[model samples]
Target: MSVTFNDFNLQTDLLEGIKSMGYKQATPIQAQAIPHILESKDLIACAQTGTGKTAAFLVPTLSRIAEGRFDFTSTLILVPTRELAKQIDDQVEGLSYFTGATSIAIYGGNNAQNWDQQKHALTSGADIIVATPGRLIAHMQMGYVKLDQLKYLILDEADKMLDMGFMDDLMKIINQLPKERQTLLFSATMPPKIREFARKILQQPEEISLSISKPAANIDQQIYLVYDQQKLKLLQHILKDVEVQTMILFTSRKSAVNEIVRALQKMGFEADGISSDRTQDERESILQRFRNKQLQVLVATDVMSRGIDVDNISHVLNFDVPQDAEDYVHRIGRTARAGTKGMAITFVNERDQERLVKIEKLIERELPKITLPEAIGESPVYDPAGNRAKFSRDKGGSGGGRGGNRSGGPRREGGSGSGDRNRSSKSRGERPAHVTAGAPATEQAPRVAGAPSTATGEAQKKKKRRKKPFKPKNAEGAGNSTPPAPAPAAE
Candidate 1:
């Protein structure tokens, strides 16, 4: 049975706000979870993205706020990322317009003015606060913020918060909250860890699980077996073949975002890239531009996969296969949202065959593979066992897909010579010397004989340099030390 907002017996003002937002009916999660929340029962609901879970908690909490009219802070919503914090803040603005409830979002950024605004809001006590765990801890560490009268504590995207290693911070904040407050824990999945965590905080919580590990049925999913060298061409082909109005292309590597965006721009597509490397203001600007249809292609790392909420995305392209199978779902979930049928295209290189298999298993269906165009040549055979072994043996040799190249975020782990991900191969523009010119088009095997001995050569060079016996032109000059250059911002 379908449930609409009119049946909830919400306060008239809150109902007006909902109508203004054009939300007449409640989603499944909303229908199941809102009643328990209205009764002040603790809740741990599992609903995937694009399922209106945010409003499920928000509507009831706002109704309580309207009914009680507490003077001090009444609600605190903790999220995993600054983007999500900002998103919830925006939603609260629209939903609370008629009710006159005040809220603010707090997140860490480089801007001094942002910090001041957050500090003021904390001291002044907004009725509701959307905050990231780390930034809220920073404010709570100072003595100005008061949550002793808080009536509701909501953890949005709770699983992602734990995955980002915020358990300690979460516990720290929870210990400071009132014991009698309502606690709502919302997540996209209900793994055992989440169940255990809920047992510690939630009190006989009502549970609702919907569409776990699943993308929408409207999505037209397709996979391409492509080699590293042929991915750029494949993407180009897809862009030319399809009519792409608005698309978000997800990559596993932050380092590769710029490269992919540049390639797309050079091919005459209006494209831009966003990552955590960008400042908070810059990331928001890019997202706004994409939402406004000013940008056709938005390239990003997985950081954008969860926090982004645009509904008109026509397609999603995975530049590189994700490290975790769950990420594949989130990435593609960006499309087929808001009742719109959409498309998802993934380029699976030889080294990522195992990852592709895991994605298939998680989704419980074999993704149809599109044949490679003749001009691009044959792709590596989909032989996960044989290719993984070749990659393992190549770790000891010299070539692309060799070992010891990983040094980045978690998504960079376990990726080996992924198409366009092998920055070494892409930069050098040539295979290693041991690799033959006419190697098999189906496999760029890391079959080199020996690894490069840069360590021994670097040791001899350092030995020769030897600090030059500490000789100095003058004793007075030696006492002065030069300051080092400022390092670049890390991703």
Candidate 2:
């Protein structure tokens, strides 16, 4: 007894828009949610990314708005990120093309002109307003934005908003909304916090759970256990070996995003980093290029995990394991979308072993371990205890060609020492025909732009180990010079 969009009894305009968008069949979330949403009932839906949750709410919301509710801002959709706000606004525009329902997207990270435009939209009362929690709150605080006639309050990616520490802001925004509004809370994972938040906001909501907290089954998952220093080389090798059409690489840190993107670009891969550091315009441009397949790879933090909905993504790379298992699901869910077979590759270092274990537990299956190409270098042995075998730094240039360092130790190209030492940006060209394990130690490679500026303390400590001072027994007989207690042990 499967259902289609035609079964939902949506307004003619919305149905036409859905057809034009080529949405024939309803996703499980969409089918279950649309009926409840059209009934003006509160809903709490637990669905994964790529599950068509956005359209599930938008279609019905738009239909209700199209019923001559254009006099005031009737529907207020709160999302977690600026990117998501824009994404929803785009969908709203397409879905309401026939209905002529008006809407505006309000988000931060732009200048006064953007703010003024948003203020105008908010005060003038569009049919709908798609906004991030923070930005909407900012407008609410100013007392110009009005939602008195609001009939619907939708929280898309509610879990993500809470994760970003917007609980208080959400409360503020919710308190300002009319108490009689229809509330909908959609999330990927429903932990205690989400249940609590839903109870506070949603009124006896009908619940829907579709593949909750699980990634798409079509995604082929693989893991590579490598040392942190070797990740770049291994990534390069993988890109060369695999036919990656367009990929999103997720790292845990903003700095890592910049570093990985710079390194990849130096290697001649079309790559760019997107983070909070980038201006809104820059991020939009980067996203546009990525969507057009002009940018081959995008290195980003978890910010892009939930916001991006690009199709035909060939691969998703977890450059660093995410702290939360739910985040792991979202990161990988970027690929293998809409029944497309995509690949997810994770780079797991020794420290990320526990996080990796958590992800496996959440997904309820162990990802297959990938064998690194010989040219990339020797992969680290998997240690369940998270203890890595200690290897001395190779005096030679960062292990050239990934066969590993001259002494079989970790190698850095410019020099193996510390300080946000930038790896030399100078192209290493193609890997040597025959990598010499006995290559002579070379001078430190010059730092490339965006390379780590702080030297890791461990490397510096290894350089200055003082030999045990021999206490002179005949200090009274010979010119006895006290060793001054070994220089009082350097701090």
Candidate 3:
């Protein structure tokens, strides 16, 4: 059944904002949970990422407060990552822009002075406070914030918080809040522990579960069987096609993110890495570049995946398979957003077979296997010889390869005609006597069967000389050069 914002009793201001945002129909989660939320009832919504669950509660919660029917710190949303906290805050703020209700986000890794200023602004009190468990607990302990009157409590990505060992802190914060408050728990997947935790917090809450048996139906999923040594080569081959534009490449660890970023850079690709170890400013800079399309690829760990909400992502690559099945879902959720078709390619090696099977079982579908070019078999030269190669040759020397020599060093000069110096000399201008066409071609010093002779090198030089200097063409002329006209402006 199709439903719209009007189906729920929302404030005029919120309905207007929804209409302005061009959302006419409610997503499944929204349709099911909005009415109950509007009624101020406890609810547990289990829906996959990209299902619009954030809006499911934000709309109704904001609407209730906007109507002047709810009072005190009426809503508290706890997310696992700073990125997610900010994302939820943005969503609530956007929906309540015209409404007088205010929302603030609180998370670690930022100046306490900034948070102090935000808290003072909320002196009259914000309608909602979106925060991570640790920061919220800190505020509660310091008396910087209060939840005594908190009426609506939400645990977004509850399972993730638990996985991160935030349970004690979450319990501490929950204990401080009023026991009579309505609770809304939402997770993409609910493990047994999360279920038990939910049971303790929610009072006979309404349950909404969407099928998690497949990747988002709109996503095109494929896996490539690769040897550990050839993973980087396969990734390079896959990325060579122009079809992949914006991408999020997931790694299992912070170190893996650095490794992948180095590999991509060595291949002359613009990319960056984000992990828990990165300073807040560094992560923000990388994310901003990615959002602005200045960076084509973002290599990130599972922790960084939660907060990435960019809609232009066209591909998600599992460079290193995730340990948790649910994480695989979240990693791929970065792409195929807003009803657009996207692709997710996973590079699986022998060690990853078990984890890949677990992921397939969790998603209840087999990922289609993609064939690769024969050249992809070339082994990657990794730095440090150990059971688990900690770094790749492209990343250069030591310490897990974190920001090492990014130039990829020099290719070994061997194999007859394959030295960098030889290639450079050939690029400038030099010709051997081999290819004077009129002379018997065989008269040439017997060059290696398939090797390039000095004559071929001279041809390369001439080709380079004939190449035109790159100049920026006028937009009008460039537009005319394409067969199809440019797309119409976005609404």
Leading candidate by lDDT: 1
TM per candidate comes to: 0.80, 0.76, 0.72
Clashes of 1: 1
lDDT of all predictions = 0.76, 0.73, 0.69
Give the C-alpha miss distance for residue 330 in model 3, angstroms.
3.7
Candidate 1 ranges with C-alpha deviation above 4 Å: 213-218, 337-340, 387-491
Candidate 2 all-Cα RMSD: 14.7
How would you encode candidate 3's per-residue C-alpha lDDT over 1-491 as one tens digit per residue? 79988988889998887887778999998999998887778898888777889999899888878887565678899987777887898788778877877888876643445555555655667779987776565445445576788888999988777765567667778887898988999988878988899988888788888866456688988877666556667787777774768888876445456777888998787999987667566878899999999998888765667778787789988876665677788778777777889998887654455667779788888777666577875322322133123333323354232221133322111101111222211100011112233322221222333423424454455555664434468645653453433323211
Error of 1 at 193 (Å): 1.8
lDDT, candidate 2, 122-235, per-residue tens: 887799898876567656756788888788999998877776556777887888888998999999888899999999999989999876457778988989988777888888
Better of 2 and 3 by TM-score: 2
lDDT of candidate 2? 0.73
RMSD of candidates 1 onward, in order: 11.5, 14.7, 22.4
Error of 3 at 212 (Å): 1.5
Model 2: CA > 4 A from native: 213-218, 337-340, 371-381, 384-491
| lDDT tens digits, residue span 1-491, model 1 | 78999999798999999999999889889999999999999999888877799999999999999998889999999987777888999999999999999999987654556767888888987999998776676567557889999889999988777765567778889999999989999998777888999999888888888865588899999999987668777888878888888999987666678878888899888899887667778889999999999999999776556678887889999877875677789778878776889999999877788888989999999999899999888977888888788777775575554232222223341134443322211111111112223321111112123312222344455555654336466866675656444332211
Candidate 1: residue pairs that collide: 228-419
